[model samples]
Target: MQIAYLMNTYPVTSATFIRREIAALEAQGVSVRRFAVRPWDQQLVDDADRQEQTRTTYLLAPGGLRLVLLTMAESLRNPRGFWRAAKTAWTLYRNAGRGALVRHVAYLMEAVHLKRLANGCTHVHAHFSTNTAAVALLCARLGGPGYSFTAHGPDEFLDPGAASLGLKLQMARFAVAITEFARVQLALAGGMGIWPKLHVVRCGVDVTDLRPAPPPATDAPFVCVGRLCVQKAQEHIVAALADLHQTHPQARVILIGDGDTRPAITAAIARHGLGEHVELRGWADNAAVKDALSGARALLLPSFAEGLPIVIMEAHALGRPVISTYIAGIPELVDQQTGWLVPAGDVPALAAAMRACMDTPPEELASMGAMARARVEAAHDVTRNATDLKALFSRYV
Candidate 1:
């Protein structure tokens, strides 16, 4: 099957394991084409360059003031129609807007983009269930075969009046939710009655290739992997550092990934005088992250929401335990058995969990980590997960 892949981001270094998934699909005999939005990120350029394959790229014709205005007005409405109208308007916006003169201009440009794309893709699938999906839906309607998208957190779930619901239900052939929790949230919030259309395909890891966690060490407390975003709750993890230090003074947090919140997360760590104990190593590439995972005691992901986070699965795959918040599809992955689940945004509880984790015996943690690996092998492997997704795509075919 030929698939046209779409995404708001091709790669941001910290995200876009999506590239690897696409590569895997291609290796499995799927003819794949890519469509992405800009401003183009370097990480994407690197991956695309490394593959040495050229893809037809399209960018919105910049300077569409009228388009922005129309989308803004449409998005400000009530909880229900906001996303729908806004999405419809934004498609017009992306191509340039719905104004009388611009409509034909935008339509002509869209047609050109498609002609350049040279349609043979069976399904057009966007990574996130938002703007890119809207773009893909328009492409499908403009004579691409069918469309689908993978829905994950933050903006898609948090935006109340987002124009994603109906677009997801009626436009796309079938949508994939990273977790069942994400699917439920889409139904409850997106006003998509046809929630059954969602296929819960996890963001998976390279199952057999996962490097096992390093043998228990005396110094490292926990490893946190994620961008320094408020959604990640890095401050909450930093807040718990002091409480953790009183007992496991030798323990330190090795933070991976960086973003706008780095300064705030750093300041919080310092305010508590735990700077010596927290190491913000900025962004590490996937290989380096795996090395850290191999060496760390446990993985900590206290994010406020998610759609089956890949970090948790990586931790489990490598036989390293996880400490995460209970929200969205997180609970579906984490539990009393795999790892500890802390309350979302709770500083004290998070702090206590850290202390307890540090104090837990190495042997016990290893045992827990083993259980974590078992969970991934049983439920989150990408091969099995891909088959399920292919089945969903076939229904639309």
Candidate 2:
């Protein structure tokens, strides 16, 4: 069967899980077309993402005039479908703020273009319950294939009404939530009656490709893999590392992603005198990330919010423990048995967890890594999740 995958931005360095999902479906003999609102504006460090860029069709890449022309042509060809899509866009504009009326109009234009681009696909699956999903919804209204979206929340749930998340959920053929917490939030927004349409589909990793490495040494540094954003709370990690420095003078952290908060985090590192202890390695390719995880004692991600970070699964797949916060779906995967789970934004608790991980025996850490790997095998295998997703799509196709 042929299907389409859509996202606001495709081939992003941090969102490798989406690529893996599409690859897995292709391996199962499905013809999957890639679509995106736009290409990632920054330089893509990963070779895989660079390759994926060539395969994606960007709605906005051809410029605004092309979108306008497509909207006009599609309206001339199918006025009824165009009106239906426009009415849906108007509802979304009303549900969201009136200030975003232009954005909603742009979504309708994008949907018109995408409908032509994805002519033969049996279904269209979008990655986030945001603008990408809005375009998908409008496309379906314009006589396109059935559409579904995976909700990875924190932003989507923050203001569901403004996001038009409830409307999207109700209109989608089926909606996927990466975690049970996310599914509950979707239910809350869409109301309890739409619960039957919501399904929990965890983001997954390639278990076989991420073979476990030898156990890390006692003096190994902690590796945190994610964007340096406010939600990721990398600043808290810097503060915690400062506190741990007195007890574990040789301790160090290697942050492996870049974002807007880099200057703030840099300032925090300097202010805390953690220039040597906290290192910002910026964005690394998948190989570098795996190497960093392989050499680390534990993965540190004291995020204030998350939708079960795939890096946690990757760290476990590489036989490394994780020291993350107990927020979102993290508590479901991490505990004392796997690694440390500290409270979000609690610098003291985070510092204590880091210290404890540093002080833990190597054998005990290895045992925790074993359990973590087992957890990934059971719940976060990319192949298995893709099969499940294909089954869901098959029902509609």
Candidate 3:
């Protein structure tokens, strides 16, 4: 089967799971074509990502005028399909407000481009229920292949109406939820009529490639891997580390990603006198992330919201425990045996968890790490999840 994968930005550091998903499908003898709405900035760091940029087609890379011309030519070729897509865009505009209307127009143009490029693909699957899915929905309306999308929550669920997620669900051949919590949220937002089409497919990790490394000899420093953004709550980690310093004077944190919050996080570290305690290592490639996890005491992510962070599974696959917030789909993966789950935004609670991890016996921590790895092997294996996804796509294809 041939599938076209649509993404707003390809090869983004934060969404490596998407790349893995595509690779897993191809491994199972499925042909996949990648399409990105816009070219990612020069910030592309990973070698794999650079290679992907060469292979994937970018819709807006040729500039706005070219897209406008393409849309016009496409409309001239198939006026009925163009009218159907334009009518859908107008409906989205009326419901989602003026700003969304402008965005949907851009999505409409991209949809036209996608329809032209998506040759021999049996289905179009988008990774998120955001702009890329918007384009996917319109592409289908403009006589493209049947489309489906995976909705990773926190953002889409935050304002489903604003994003017109319900309409997208109504139009899609199927909708995928990464977690049960996300499935429930999609049901609520999209209504029960769309429930039959919703399926729970957990985001997964390639455990074989991430075999457990020997734990660090000492639990002095921890590692946190994700974008340095507000939702990640890295600031809370900084605060917690400050509190831990009062007891564990040698406590340190290696932040493995970078974003808009870097300056603020740096300020927080300095303000809390954690200049030496918290080190922002900036963005690292996947191999570098695994290497960092190999040497770290545990993975720390105090996100206020999430859709079962793939990093948690990665940490588990690497035989490292995680200390993360208990919000969204996190509790399903993290537990008393695998790792600690504290309430989001609770600095005191997070600090206590950090202290407990630091104080735990090495043998006990190793046991927990073992259980963590076993959990991922059983539940979040990428190859297995890909098989499930392929089965789902086969039904429509």
Candidate 4:
């Protein structure tokens, strides 16, 4: 089957799962074409191009210098793609004569982005609920194959109207949400009868290849992985590290991933005198991060909001229990068996949970870790997820 994968920003350094999922599908002999918005800004263009399988295309819209604007004039304003193009034109016209209007012209570029992906694909699946899905849905409406998308996390789930849910549902044949919570909320936000079409498809991880934790010779190391942003609640993790240090001074804390809040998080570490105990290792790739998770005593993610974060699934697959917040769909994975879930923004509670993990014996922690692996294998296998996608795509066929 021919498939087109759409994302708001492809080659995003932060979200390697996009590439992982595309690789998983192509491995099954499916013809997968990749498309992205704002392509030039991405640094991994070389990585996608070097791939022997799947064809990768960049949707450079109407703004650049010459070609895109002319293409927009022909294809975007074309009858099949008129409504979206008109909306784009209107947005541009509204801001006309101002230099700022030029950027809004990017919307017109969606006409070309969609048209190119629709050419031979049997299905179009976009990631997240930003304008990326808008472009995919717009193309599907203009005689493209059935289109769908996977929505994730805060920006998309927290603010529904930003993605134009009415238009999204009207154009989408199916909608996938990373968490059950996200699925229900998107249904409510869409304000359409298509609520029944929403599906909960948690992003999966490779269960077999994950490395096992070290033998019980060394003291357990606690780690947290994700961008150091507000939603990640790294600050809470820092507070927990302080508590861990006061009691179990032998416990070591390592942080992976980088973002806007690095300075503040680093400053917090200094304020708490956690320099000796805590270390920041920024932006490790999937394999490296998984290796870290494999050896860690626990994977900490005290986030303020989430949509079944892929990291949590990966951690469980690697045999590590997660210590996370109860917000959104987090409770689905973390519960009495696998890990602890505390209220969002509760630093003291998070601190206590960390101490509990540190104080727990190695044999007990290992049993919980084994449960993590079992839970992931039973529910979130990558192949199973792809199989379901094939069945879902058959509807459009």
Candidate 5:
């Protein structure tokens, strides 16, 4: 069967899990077409993602006039579909706040463009229940392929009204939640009717691609991988490191991602006199990330919110235990056995965890690392989860 995968921006540094999902499906004989609303203009560190950008069709790349002309031709060719899409757009404009009218109109135009391009596809699956899902809903209304979407938390659940997540869930043929925690949130927002359409499909990593590296022989710097954003709380990590330095002066942390919060992170490093202990490596590709994980004492992520971060799984797959906050779907993957779990925003507790990682015996840390790898093998195997996702798509198609 043929399928179209829709994304807001293709090959984003943090959302590589989506790329893995698409590759796994294609490996199993699924004919998949990749579509992005816009091209990612940021510096791409991964060669694989750079290659994927060439294969994806960007809907907004043809300029405004071309989009208007193509949309007009599509409307003239299929008047009934045009009316259906128009009615849907009108409903969204009326029900969604007045400020969203222009955005909804843009979604309608993009839907028309997608309907023209997505020929011979049996289904369309989008990654987020935000803008991409809104466009997918309109695409279905415009006589395009049946559409579904996956909802990852922190944003959609925090502000469902602004996101119009409930309406998107009702419109989709099926909906995917990355964890049971996310599924429950979708049910709460969309009501009991959404339960039937919701499925739990985790964002996973390929274990075969990850070779287990020996644990660090001595105390090594901890590594954190994710966007340098407020939600990730990298600043908190910097603060906690200051407290940790009083006891374990040798403790160091290397943050391996980039975002708007870099200035604040840099300030924290300078403010706390952690310049020597903290290092910002900007963005690294999957290969570089693996190399970073292989030599680390542990992986640290003091996030205030998450949808079960793929970096946690990647760290586990490489036999590196994780130290993350107990928020969102994080508890489902991390525990005392796997690593340390601290409450979010508690600097004292975060510092204590960092100190524990430094003080723990090498043999005990290695044992925990082994358990971490075993857990990932059992729950986050990309090949197995991709088969389950394909089966779900088959049932709908």
Candidate 6:
């Protein structure tokens, strides 16, 4: 069966899980038409993502005039559908905060274009219950394909009204959550009546592609893989390192992602005299990330909010334990056995976990890494999870 996959942006550096999921679906004989609101203008680290860029059609690529023309054409072709979709967009705009009118209008135009593009697809599925979902919802109202979306939090949970989460869920044929925690949040946002529409389909990593590597020495530097953002709380990692450095000066940490928080993290590293102990490696491709994880003692991500990071699974697949927080779906996968679990924003607790990683014996660490690998193989195999998604799509189609 043919399907349309929509997103706000495609072929990005951090969202490789989506790429993997699409690839797995294609391998199972599903034809996927990729659509995005816009293309990633930044450098993509992975060649797979680069290839995906060629396959994705950007609805906004034609700019304002083209979108206006398409909207006009769509309205003339299906005046009734256009009117219905326009009303939905108006409702969304009224529900949103100040300055959201322009955004909703753009979503309306994008939906008009998507309605033309996704004509024959059985259904459309979007990642993130944000603008992509908004556009998808509007497109369905425009008599396009029925659409569903996957909600990843805690951004979605932070402000459901701004995202129009309830309305999106109410209109969607089915909704997917990356974790059970995320599913619960979707149910809360969409109301209990829509609970039957919510399903848990985890973002997964390919275990075969990311096979376990030899465990690193206990004293090896830790690696953190994620965007350097406020939600990731990477600055807290620097603070914890500073505290850890007071006792273990030889300890080292490598941060393997990049974002707006680089300046703050860099300043903190300098302020704490941790230039030698902390290295901001910026963005690395998938191969480089796996290599970095292979050599690291463990993965560290003290995120203030998350919907289960794919990096944690990647590290676990590589037989490396994680040092993360007890937030969202993390505790479901990571605990004392997998790696260290510290309270978010607690610099002292983070420092203690860092110390624990430093002092843990190599054999014990390997044992923990083995358990981590087992957990990932059991719960996060990409092919298996994709099959579950395929089943859901089949039921709808």
Provide the TM-score for each candidate, comma-separated: 0.84, 0.98, 0.98, 0.89, 0.98, 0.98
> Tens-digit lDDT track for model 1 on 8-68?
6554565546766776676666777766665444443244434522453544533456445
lDDT per residue (tens digit) for residues 194-255 in model 4: 77788877777766666456533357677888878998989778888787678878888789
Q: RMSD for each model, in Å, please?
A: 6.5, 1.0, 1.2, 3.5, 1.1, 1.1
**Descending-lDDT candidate ranking:** 2, 6, 3, 5, 4, 1
User: In candidate 6, which residue pairs get closer than 3 Å at backbone N, Cα or C atoms, i.e. clash?
Assistant: none
- Model 3 clash pairs are none
Output the lDDT of residue 52, model 2.
96
C-alpha positional error of residue 38 in candidate 3 after TM-score superposition, expressed in Å: 0.9
lDDT of 1: 0.70
| Candidate 6 TM-score versus the reference | 0.98
lDDT of 6: 0.92
Instruction: For each candidate in the order shown, give its overall lDDT on alpha carbons.
Output: 0.70, 0.92, 0.90, 0.72, 0.90, 0.92
* Range of the 10 consecutive residues with the lowest summed lDDT in candidate 3: 212-221
lDDT of 2 by residue, 241-330 (tens): 999998999999999999989999999999988888888899999999999999999999999989899999999988899999988889
Candidate 4 TM-score, C-alpha based: 0.89
Residue-pair clashes per prediction, in order, are 4, 0, 0, 0, 0, 0
For residues 1-397, could you state the per-residue lDDT of candidate 5 as single tens digits?
9999999999898889989999999999999999999988898889999999899998888878888898888789999998998898887777677698878878888898888789999999999888899899999999999999988987878778767778888888999999999999999889998799899988889999887788785868899999999999999999999999898888889999999899999999999998888999999988999999998999999999888999999988888889999998999989999899999999999999988888888888888989999988888988888898899899998
Those runs of model 6 whose alpha carbons end farther than 4 Å from true positions after fitting are: none
Return whichever of 4 and 6 wins on lDDT: 6
In candidate 6, where is summed lDDT lowest over 10 consecutive residues?
A: 211-220
**Candidate 6 or 5, higher lDDT:** 6
Question: Candidate 1, residue 93: CA error in Å?
Answer: 8.0
Question: Which residue pairs collide in model 1, if any?
Answer: 83-162, 83-163, 84-163, 214-294
Worst 10 residues of 2 by lDDT: 388-397
